[model samples]
Target: MKKDKPKYKLIIDAAVVVIAENGYHHAQVSKIAKQAGVADGTIYLYFKNKEDILISLFEEKMGQFVQKIRNKMSGTDDAVDQLKVLVESHFQMLADDHHLAIVTQLELRQSNKDIRMRINKVLKEYLVLIDDVLQRGVDSGSLSEDLDIRLARQMVFGTIDEVATSWVISDQKYSITELSPGVHRLLVKGLCK
Candidate 1:
């Protein structure tokens, strides 16, 4: 698969920077290629167009995001601890990659319906992870037995999403990771029995 190639990763990473700096509409294939240190034609080998690159970039980054959270969650069986891990990992990864944070929180939001739909499809895997944690908490009776998994999952994701958007909008003036514990506690309180 093309994803297994080194240039695919380089192109993806470069697309993140290019898209972040230029905004998706203005980001040209040449710019992405230059950022990746490859010829513009090389980009065509891996992607159909700019939209494809944007989608692939998100797919690549979000894949890593889910894997990292899963790895962190492996150390704990407690639903609450797993939630904490998810929250912290979410904040920390974005905090560590400013370009990625910008692409995700800002540029990605400006995408068209088709792009948004594809992005949402990729997001389902992440939302499912949250559903798992909420289900576990409810099963253990730590969270409200009457809790609606779908609603809780939305609230959890929306809260984290809004907070990250605010940070990106403010030019990342504060430490997003520092807000994780507070965010975790607030969400947990609502779901807890």
Candidate 2:
């Protein structure tokens, strides 16, 4: 049976909040069902299990995130500008969705090793976008051709992840958007020729 798009979104949104509030081990289908305002059995109709819910939540949110950045980058021709937009968009998305930020940065990490591995797979799409920008910069002579794409991508992603996690731990007092320019500058300096 086909599910309504809004209903599916609501379920995912509710799951994020439930998971964020309760660690993964404590997050039960019943809790998510209550958060979504659906019966416990209704969750089963949509998801096979709690792990399924978590995986789907990551997939849905990350998919939309990647698509939004892809659309935004379509208007910019410069690789450097695209990289800036990608960094800004990523930080801004996490900042704008505090619930999602908690889920992604905190609760999601509480999952077992296996689940974390699957979540990493979903995150690769975003990392690939970063790599694409770096490759473009190298091709355009804006960045050093000798830069190792894999290591550069890791540094960029790892730095941003650390920054975001620190903000989340600190209660997010300052605006994450403010860090975008500095991050862009540092990345460009490290990678540019």
Candidate 3:
């Protein structure tokens, strides 16, 4: 598959920077190729068009994002600890990658309906991870037994998402990672009490 190639990753990384700097609509393939230090035609070999690049880039980044959270949470068995890990990891990832933060919190939202739909498809895996943590919490009685998994998942994800977006909008003037504890506490309280 094209994803296995080094160039595919190069293009994806390049696309992230390009899209973040220029916004999705203005991120031309030639610009991405130049950023990746590849010929313009080379991108075609890996993607159908600009839209394909956007979808694939999101898919790749989000996959890595979920994996990173999983790895970080692996040391803990407590659902509450796992939830904290997820919140901390989510904020830390955006804090670590400013470009990625901009793209995800801003440019990605600016995409058309079809692209947004595809991005949602990619997001399902991450949501399932959240659901798993919530399920574990209910099982362990750390969270409300009456907790609606679907609603709680949305709230947890939405809260984390809003905080990140606010950071991006403020030009990242403050430490988003430092706010992780507060965010975690808020979610835990909602889930537990």
Candidate 4:
């Protein structure tokens, strides 16, 4: 029987949950297959190996994330607001999906160097979007021209990442969505003139 796109997406979703619940080392193909409701052999038909599934998952989900933010920010011309949307959208994406939060914030980091590199490749698109916003700010004289775009991008990413990781570690007790404005303010204050 031929599998459809939705079926593949379902498998990836199941894999994310399995990986999040069980660390990467402990999450076996068989376990993911069971969680995905497909036979172990069937998983092979869709993915070459476990690593492929992970890379594919990041690509698919992160692609959607970038697309959504791009769509939402279309009418907003202010670089600061663009930056705000970027940060908020990122946190909101993870917040909306607890399973994805666990997988992205915890389990995915447990992968080896190569897998991590691949994940970074998938994340570059988002980083580029941040960089574009910073560049626009500099161009408009809204942000300090002396600021290092690369380091600034890293700072934004690092801050949001640390915040999300903290939330995950704390069992998500606080409202991540509520923190967006403050985070955006701090970032803007530091980066702007």
Q: Candidate 1 regions off by >4 Å?
A: none
For residues 77-108, write the lDDT of model 3, one tens digit per residue: 89999999998899988998999999999999
Least well predicted 10-residue stretch by lDDT in candidate 4: 1-10
From the highest TM-score down, the ranking of the candidates is 1, 3, 2, 4
Error of 1 at 164 (Å): 0.2
For 62-144, candidate 1 gives per-residue lDDT tens digits of 99899989988999889999999999999999999999999999998899999999999999999999999999999998889
TM-score of each: 0.99, 0.95, 0.98, 0.94
* Candidate structures ordered by lDDT, highest first: 3, 1, 4, 2
Candidate 4, 1-193: lDDT as tens digits: 3234666887888888988888778889999989988889988888899999888888888999999999988878788989999889988998899888988999889889999999999999999988988899899888898989999999999999999999998988988988999999999999997
Global lDDT for candidate 4? 0.89
Query: Which of 1 and 2 is the better model by TM-score?
Result: 1
Note the Cα lDDT for every prediction shown: 0.95, 0.88, 0.95, 0.89
How much is 161 displaced in model 4, in angstroms?
0.8
How many clashes does the backbone of model 4 have?
A: 0
Expressed as tens digits, the lDDT of each residue in 51-108 for candidate 2 is 9899999999999999999999999768889989888998999999988988888888
Model 1 alpha-carbon miss at residue 181, Å: 0.9
Cα shift from native, residue 183, model 1 (Å) = 0.5
